[model samples]
Target: MKNASPRWFTSSYSENGGVCVEVATNLAASHGTVPVRDSKTPTGPSLAVSAEAWTTFVAMTRH
Candidate 1:
């Protein structure tokens, strides 16, 4: 939904001087996807990743 508001946030592990991506997982359940965007440009475009893909990525990062 274009009207949907995404709550974007970076991971706690991000310590590279703000050079990291922000993800809005809040809409995953309803939209079936995770919205990712650059922290430097909140007004810019975002990438919508499938929930499954997001889960896999997180799992890999945890390893």
Candidate 2:
């Protein structure tokens, strides 16, 4: 991904005006990484975690 802004996606389970979380799917494909940031600020800094790390974090959050 170059010469462009990152695309962020919120969880499908999120309700209207709720749980402001956004993730960049593009990062996953190019670098095998997951970039996450606040949906409220699209241009803000994000945290990148490895694919395996991301999955493990999600599993922990789910439980």
Candidate 3:
């Protein structure tokens, strides 16, 4: 895959103060990974999780 930039975005439901994480799902198709970082620190280190794992995690949280 090419070097794709991560387009970070926070959830609309995360309105409870400034404690939230940002996710870059835009690279899931091209990179097969989802980069996640803290909303408080945009320049901080991010965690790269597998696309499949991220999907499962989100599905579990919805239950």
* TM-score leader: 3
For residue 48, model 1's alpha carbon misses the true position, in angstroms, by 0.1
lDDT of 2 at 49: 78
Q: Write the per-residue lDDT of candidate 2 for residues 7-53, one digit (tens) a residue.
A: 77898888778658887767666778888888877777888878778
- List per-prediction Cα lDDT, in the order shown: 0.91, 0.79, 0.95
Tell me how far the alpha carbon of residue 14 in candidate 1 is from the true structure, in angstroms, after superposition.
0.8
lDDT of 2 at 25: 68
Q: How much is the lDDT of residue 55 in candidate 2? A: 83
Candidate 1 segments whose C-alpha is farther than 4 A from its true place: 1-3
Cα lDDT tens digits for candidate 1, 1-63: 555778888988899697899999988988999999988888999999999999999999889
lDDT score at residue 15, model 2, on the 0-100 scale: 78
Per-residue error for 23 in candidate 1, Å, reads: 0.4
Candidate 2 structure lDDT: 0.79
The candidate that wins on lDDT is 3
Q: Using TM-score as the measure, what is the rank order of every candidate, best first? A: 3, 1, 2
lDDT of candidate 3 over 1-63, digit per residue (tens):
588899999998899688999999999999999999999999999999999999999999999
